[model samples]
Target: MFKKIAVPVLLAVSGVAAAAEGTTTTGVDLTPLTNSIDFSTVLVAIMAVAASLVTLYAGVAGVRWVLRTVKSA
Candidate 1:
């Protein structure tokens, strides 16, 4: 009984190990995929400009608010 159960388990484990080792080599080139229109730089520049505008607007609004408050006082 032990021999029967152990033999099938060992065979299943060996089959799984062999299947894991059988890797197919890919022949596809990925240079074109990597070189195609990188947008990270443009995205970063746009994000920087947007952030600067938001900061400038915030500064201007803060100054205006302070001026109005001082004037009211």
Candidate 2:
């Protein structure tokens, strides 16, 4: 069923791509722009992940401590 629609679309796209002019990449330099970009979001995400792990560890420890105390009593 999908082949009926996909074949013609694929052939059309290929034909257009084949007929495209000046599809060459020459002298493209984005070094200066990329170098100045701040990557603080990735650091913040890592800190958030650390916070979640700490919270999970604390919850598990508290539950285990309460269970131990109850069992001892």
Strongest candidate by lDDT: 1
Clashing pairs in model 2, backbone N/Cα/C closer than 3 A: none
- Model 2 per-residue lDDT tens digits across residues 1-73: 8999999999999988887764666777899999998889989999999999999999999999999999999
TM values, all candidates? 0.52, 0.52
- Stretches > 4 Å off in candidate 2: 1-36
How would you encode candidate 1's per-residue C-alpha lDDT over 3-61 as one tens digit per residue?
A: 99999999999999999798668767889997998899999999999999999999999
Stretches of candidate 1 off by over 4 Å are 1-35
Whole-model lDDT per candidate: 0.95, 0.93
For model 2, give the 10-residue run with minimal summed lDDT. Answer: 19-28
Compared with the true structure, the alpha-carbon lDDT of candidate 1 equals 0.95
Where does the lowest 10-residue lDDT sum fall in candidate 1?
Answer: 20-29
